[model samples]
Target: MALNPPSPTPSMFRKKKSSSSLGPMSTAASYLSAVRAADARARARGDTPLTTPALSLSSSVTTSSEDTILDEGEESYSDILTYPSIPPTSEQVYTTVHSEFGHCSNEEYRAVSQHPAGKPVAPHVEQDPPYYVLFTTYISYIILILFGHLRDFSRKYFNPGEFKHLVPHDGYAPITSDFDSFYTRRLKGRMDDCFSYPVTGVAGRTIVLLERESKDSNRTFAPTGRKVRTLNISSYNYLGFAQARGGCADAVEECIKRYGVSACGTRVEGGSLDLHSQAEGLVANFVGQEDALLCSMGFATNSTIIPALVGKGCLVISDELNHASIRFGVRVSGANVRMFKHNDMKDLEDLLKEVISQGQPKTHRPWKKILLIVEGLFSMEGTMTNLPSILELKKKYKFYLFVDEAHSIGALGPHGRGVSDYFGVNPRSIDILMGTFTKSFGAAGGYISGSRVIVDRLRVRSHSHTYAEAMTPPVLTQVIASMASIMGVTPALPTSTSTGTITKSRMPEPEVPEAYPGRALSSSLPTWMDLPPAMREGTEGRDRLRRLVFNSRYLFRGLKKLGFIVYGHDDSPIIPLLIFNPGKMSMFHRLMRQYSTPIVVVVVAYPATPLVTSRVRFCVSASHTKEDIDTVLRASDYVGDVLDLKHSDGERWPLERIMNSAVELVQMEQPSHD
Candidate 1:
């Protein structure tokens, strides 16, 4: 119009405000023409044409030369297009370009360029074109190569053939060589199988709150949202101290404040604190030993210390029913180990005599030392060791004796001094006195007490002493406080005794009162029966032990009267009820849950015991009242009858009934013969 300026370039026209007023097809045509022209210009400048595809436009949309110029009536086109619009800053341009290529941000591209593996950008090159475009393209190619290799590797190795051997094969190897295979195949669906239940609340002698197993679970037992509260008769809270709150808890809290929790390192490093030494001294004095060494765990005390004490030239004769810790310890000791029948003094003596006569293996040389290891109380069988008989054999054979008082300590004897005090055998007769604080002490860790030489040697030689972290301050303090309560006096200094032959003293049975009719009070008395009457009258350790014995007898009698076959001694707190049939065992467990008054008891079976010899075990505590014991007894009788677990009137097991009948008939015939 008024000598109009040369028409604006197509690129400028594409950005004009009038372009927004165009139809969709016209707008597409304009964009396509602008992109084509830009590519042509780039090619004319000796650069590669833009590789990005141009926008496609419909054939009906057309643009003429007249459309490129604006009319004078529309005002100056340059005035509108050349207005001072803000230009994008470097950060804004980088962000916009990065987003177009699916990159997270420009910072990410810069980070890659700085990497040692990435290509360096030349100073002459622009920042946007080189760093982001090149690095992203390089990363994508590398990822594709890696994915190709991964696919190839998966095809070659992760195939069915790789795992074919795990299935059954017609080979010489037995199908069930180990427990894992055996449990997988044979015992797969037996849901109520023993030893997997998770208990809640206090695992005390009487009451326990536990989550019930869900009936819907198939592969494994799972706890339900609902909880069952019942009388607990399965725990090993021997002296009712597992949940002690008064003194034990107080002592632990005080030490926690002072030490601030863990010892932080191994005993040989920074873990050994003043509390550890004081606790060790207390344990040694209580056990009447010259010195004692403490370890963080009860089981490791035996498992590790045994190897440190003896080697290949030595012989270790172990009790068949000794704790698993002792069995494992003997295996690790590298000594010639021999096992005698459980609690059989004659079998032990014969084995000892034979080994002594035979001497060492192969070379037939005399053994460097012979060690006898036994437990003060057998946990599984609920029986105490024949300490007097074992001591006599040790004397004649000239062997060292190791006593594990895990169950008996703080639970047996007049002063809770363990088997030596229970049987009136001198403590000096035992070479090594090993006991745990877990059971009756209501604490964690174990102590190995003996002569100064043995204790010092173990501290230096035992791997646990050098490497394992020392017992935590709180646990050590708990043990110290609980032990003080049990002893009824402060922990005194250990006194040295002559190693000369100790005179044996037999424990006399307590005189039963004639007031109670048709009952021998001595039959229900505990090992603390020999405690002084003055001490027994008080609410001391002896009274607590006596209450435990009374509860045990009550439960034992109730089970027997209900026609249930019970195991263990009358005065023993652990009571076992036989349920030989696996089906009946599972049924008994279920029925107990369903009973009006539900009761919780432990069921022991295969692996823990021999196959088909599953039994329901009950542990009576001083905490258990007569009402609690009665409730469990009544529930057991009902469940036993419902499951047909009770023995028939004339049907004793293993030919006992037939043998008795034959004896009666022979006696009648004898009268006719006379």
Candidate 2:
């Protein structure tokens, strides 16, 4: 009668396990009272000595091995995930597999997510690597280019057959110009192994990667028929909502049972569902917006919606490092575009002033409107946009502000409401709030939230809404459940461990009044969505937010203390450690994967980042335990020394010492030598 995972089905997803002993879903002996009876039995039987849920309940990716249940009698594996340093006592209980969700009971590990009152938000610092590392990185690319040219030279003479694609036949244009693909053939082609490795199962705390090998230098690959399980630190699974089980998953499963897989057509073409409205309403509430609309795809949410906001006569001032989708949309919109240095408020103000003073290019006529676009959290650099400063600029310049919170929503803020919540500013101050559910909600699609007028306008004008498929019922359910968990629900039910109502205000001082939107009400969720006690009370959601911040700070600061050049704000869930040398990107990845406890990492080089600043980005999740962070720190320390990547000018801490003083390190102001 418990909510354990069902046995695996031939299909990708398995249905939730139901015991034969329990009454039927449709009460055999009652009327509309069927649902009430089922729910009553569920809630009453769920009453237990444990107050808090053993597993974290945020959005997440997949279940481990078809959501495997923890067998109390089975002997634990030697793996760190299975047999953690401090195993749970026999008296304690667990509902999750250790590989999927690391067990951490130490409440002391938690930290609140909020800026100190009256103090300025900490500025993002980019620690530069050693000059020699930069030189070598350039040399590595130069050597690859030289070899590529030499290969082309030899092939043209001795192996002319392979060069036919670049030569025109019968007056038809060649397949593609050789020069057009020079970078891909010369540079990226060599290290395709480190990128896009095949993976399976839930992308939770751990991920299962399918093994493949290539003999012709990554031109093609053949599966080795082997699967490797590795510690997952590369997914956008902030808050660990990328789960295949727990409240979120259960809700999704129920949704699939009631509502089929697809929405059948585009939103405007008779494809919208009641769940669409439900999700839109919850999303609007979550981001503190008046109303919101959903796009079937995250990329389209920006690429399609931006065109509806601005056109030929308008001006778009965007962060230079803004996502490509934004640039594409701006170009398509035919808007006059201006670029500003990433997250640099001074550069932004200068650009804004120049655009205002200059007016429309050449015509010297005033622009119809000016729109400034910035990401709430930079995915690669992990820099939080200067919201407070931008709001001040918004007041002075009177430009429409559109913040893309694709990476920040449900991952930042004390309440997990996103950047506006994180920065202690009113969400409505900004003209538009755009976010995607993929990052933190562990679901697909995106949303654009703002005043009702703006949202209603986009629905009619945006290409995605008019053409693309509406979001499916399952994804919408995941969004609603995960978001509700984060916002918390009303008509609370007390738990065995409950000690009065939970306080969400984590401000250092009490008198300052709440600076962000408050919790969600019961009416915000659907009448059918029945969340467990912990999620109902917002306890699990609160725990996940605190856990994420703790891990984020620990990883960012820990790498710096290990004498590595780590980029981004310490509170950022996305932590990038500089790899510098392009060649070592593959080496670092392979070495980490080959560790005693295999760790999967994502490596980025030129194009995504500067050539000299190639880095391995580690996305922290609440699913990770404190010990898991220690494991990553230890792995990086060993790998850094081997690859000579530790080049920052800082007091380096010993690996053992770093592991021992983690809680102290997370609590301290980052970059402090102590």
Candidate 3:
């Protein structure tokens, strides 16, 4: 039901009007007389005046001083009542009337101000006015009061119960559970404590950093602003190119000098410069694509381009574990979407066969198009997609494929050409090739590399290309320089295939040791010396890739031996330490910080991963040394034991058993060529 204004009481009309008042006047004059009468009545009741001198309407009213003078020689109507020669504009009249009278008590105004001018007005009148103007004003004030009450009711009663848990009792609080509440209340005190550890210098062999704890008194371990030299493992500086002194940095400096900072607008507008074109060309050449289009942000490239390619009437078959950006894009596209289990070819095939047989939902007609989307590497799980299997399914289903290689671009494959190269699949088999320059490239944008037709279409139709600001000149040049380094064309760097061979002394230990009490404490020798010669021998880029693999394997093996359940493949740089219990997860993170050799790792919890499987994700970078890996392993071993996280038979799982299991996994993942 619609709320109404309260009816006025009879006592409100009992007040009398003043003597020497002017008779009924024009609308503007009536308003002014009402305000003056209300002000006088308020003073009689010992209440504060409605309008102070600070809010005087005299500046806008333009009343002459002579209008107030009483003539002693002749008492005439002309001398008593004075009106302006020119009527004030409606805006001016409203402003002056409201400024002087808006704050007056409505009840008091109804008693005295509503009385007829020039008459000795009383609070109680036998007859009422005939005009509807005053009645409409009362209704508006009533509506405003009702709106205020409704707003308070919604805040107090309509908001979700979860939101109240995070907010204070009285002051303004969030009425909904959103990103802020999720971070501040649910994950901030625990997960944020581990991520974004403040570092004083470059993420090198040994990083000078600060660690945070999840305590009230000392939430951060390094509260004194002191930095500790600890093993660096949290970054994605793959290929060891992020900290290059003279290569990419020099090119970026030169580019900045040639073209100031930013492109200033969208590519089609004034923002497109020669450097942008050069970078695009270099990226296309590096990735073996006919053309490439750059966007200001890597996340935006996928989110914007996917919608442009397909929309309603289209079907998007996606991996269950695809990045959030891809999910956002598919949602924006308004496409009918179906997700298959992560890396499960059999499940994907079954779903595809069912969809093909049934046709589009609700309509027994063929879909306009079908798009298959998957990531080159699942960042959270550190598992590579079975591209060969997916390609075979794509061939059978006749669907276009989109691969987001944000993590695999410069870190995967023998020559670092991404997943297609790593798996020996032809790049042309995939319909869309998307990657970001932020990770291995150490730049600030992303690119979409595909056929000439696709590139041309995106240039004109993609919302990001049409509306967003172009990539800045410095970031473009940085990407170009990194691509050159990876391609072995930079004079300052060694060629890709021209590095020294691995020495026999650097070979890894062939046998896994038995469980011992002092295994972690006994490791004084550097662990890099024990890496396989195959890992140590290669060109600079290949060597870094091998080191990344070696470190990942070493860390995974050590964690398994320590009895902590880990996730992902051994070859993948991403290793997730699974801590299923939320309270245990928080405790594990806190203990990791307090370890003698403190290390920073990314913690993924609810909304990112399932609530039941919260984990600490470690990204093994090539820049990490063998000693650095061992330090973190020792710390994990000690903490895992303290928290009773180790399995009873963890140490009994020997190297041979681990290798056999990996072989079985590979055989299961491989597609039959027959």
Candidate 4:
């Protein structure tokens, strides 16, 4: 009987090509028909493949065409594509055991090794068993260690979930080691309270666009589906200088040409350029001082200038409501510091008396100096300094006066010459005049304009001034240009005062004609009094200060006549129709969205302002015309009626109630040093 062959079993791996064959011409025809049919169906369905099923058997193959795949060894083209298949498993080699004579034995081999039926045999090794086992274990252990390290690295560097667990959330302190647990805990609490209040979720009413087809053009936010840009405020471009006379563009161009890009190093190093000197010169001339020293920043101007001017033997008497920058600078100076009550002349006199009393003792330094520090204007409450009173006390105490004219420099005094001019105090009387270029000049940097001796002393002695990066060439250049443009054209103060001191006799009656021309008596005097008291307080005060206040009055009357309970003041441009609760800010913001004109709010919160003071600050700009202001007032009135601020006391806070509440709120916001 003939030996039978074993049947083939299916293998795990599948081959891409089949080994079966067909009659030559018939196979080619059948493949062509199949591919053509496929192409027709794909075309009908709008499907396209990268490579066509057509095969080129021509010797001169065109490999450039993507739709054709060329095959080797054929003389003509064919529709079918072919690939060779693997041989059967039976054809592969298998290890087998045989007799020493190299022949299979009929009887089962029983000598040294046994060959089992239907199985392959391995070749025997001559090496020692222990050596082989040791090598195998070494290789396997190394592979496992490598795999473990790879898993650890991936978890540390690339796993998003693992990284998220490592970071701290907004309210919490990051997991850093700390030396002071109490301090860290307190800081974390403050941060949490500040962030917890929600400002974004307030409902905003859609502003009706005056454009005829605006309804279809309105866009909704993607995530929350809310409309943004309903009302906007909180911008620092005071005096609208950014848009003044191509000022912004000129600044940018100058900055680019001189500095190229960055100040490369600190002021003492590569940063100081010739433009810086030009700016310093201009500032000194404008302030009517002999010389000036420039610094990289305004904060540094205060922090560095104060500490340098007052040290071990000096005393600094500060106004209690002074700007935070001034307070911090005083603290850092390590001087014997005392604070007087806000704008209280009596309190200031008492403090000076105590300083003078102590200074008279023989044990103390004989040449001691007391520096009185105060701001020209209080930023938050819009209050101003009693310069006449302070100057009177200064004459008695012989203390040096250092006033921060930060807010007042750009907005107060005749031609904005600042507080010295406003109160008719000579720049020489102040001893040292420090101002920043960032504000009215529309640039950055600061300078101390004063007697040459004081400025020269500070130039070398100030720590940050000596060590910090200097102002950029372009920024300094722009500052110089702006000073030249504004100060050069600004009319000068009448000069040659015949030596009269400030007294009660010179004080004008409150109801004197609002517009007082010839306020500056002489052309020789570089500084003259400008801002009157009424300009800083109440309804009449605001009206005297700005045109916006007038518009606000018109708006208020219109709104009142229209029967809306409008909140806040017509005297002050910052009017807010009070919404009693947190829930109402959203509704107020929403109604504001429906107006054609924008009425932005300056939002205040728990940490920034008191909860009671948590209302929008509606600011009227000088840029707004009477018509524009009227439109805004009408819209606000309409919205106020809709929100129902008229009936509730919370909605309409009286001016006195508002002022008292403001004072209390300020007290609360201040940090308790004790």
Winning candidate number (lDDT): 2
For model 4, residues 1-674, the per-residue Cα lDDT tens digits are 21221121111111112232222322222333344454455545543431211111111212221111122223211222332344322211110000000111111111110112223212211112234333544454355446545654576577756434345666775465332332223222222222222233211111111111112222211223222222222333333333212333344454565456656333446445555655665566667677788887888889888988887677888887677777778888888788997777777888777767767345755436788888765554344566666777888878898888765564454444566655556667778877777655556777787888998899888976788777766566556544443343233323444446733333322322112111211121112212112211122112212432333344443444444434432232334443434434555654554444434444443333333333444544333333333345445555655655443322344333422343232222211100
Superposition-based RMSD of candidate 1 using all C-alpha atoms, in angstroms:
35.6
- Over 1-674, each residue of candidate 1 has an lDDT whose tens digit, in order, gives 12221221112112124322322322222332333354445556534412221111111112221121111122322222121234322212111111111111111111000011122211111012224433544564355446644654574476845334444556645444444543543343453444456654455542323454546544555655544444466777766666423334445655666666444333536546676776776677677777799988999999999999999999998988788888888889899899998777778888888998999999989999998898886776666677777777777889999999987776666566776766656687799999999877767788899999999999999977888878877777667656655554411224445567755454543433222011122222221122222222323344456556556656655565566666554445677777766556666776665555555678776667665456788887765544455456656655766665565233222222322232232122110000
TM-score of every model versus the real structure = 0.62, 0.83, 0.62, 0.50
TM-score of 3: 0.62
lDDT of 3 at 67: 20
Tell me the tens digit of each residue's lDDT in model 2 across 1-674. Answer: 22222222121112223221112222111311232343344445553211112221112224433233333321221111132334323222132334556655566788876766456655565767667777778888889889999988988899887778888877877899887577788789888988899998789887878878999999999987767767799999998888655778778777777766554333536656788887887788778888899988999999999999999999999999899989999999999999998778888899888889989978989999999999988888888888888899999999999999999998888888888888778899989999999988899999999999999899899998888877877888888898888877766333344358854442232222122366666656676778876777787788899999999999988998899888788788999888888889988999888765678999998888987888999999998878678768877887887888888886888887887898898888643110
Say which prediction, candidate 2 or candidate 4, comes out ahead on TM-score: 2
lDDT string for model 3 (60-170, tens) is: 111121121112122221232343444333222322222111222212111000112233211111122223423443453355446644654576477746346546557
Global lDDT of each candidate: 0.57, 0.76, 0.58, 0.46
- The total of clashing pairs for model 4 equals 21
**Alpha-carbon shift of residue 367 in model 4 (angstroms):** 8.8
CA lDDT for candidate 3: 0.58
Better of 1 and 2 by lDDT: 2
By lDDT, rank the candidates, best first. 2, 3, 1, 4
Candidate 3 ranges beyond 4 A from true positions = 1-174, 178-192, 195-197, 204-206, 210-223, 262-271, 490-539, 648-674
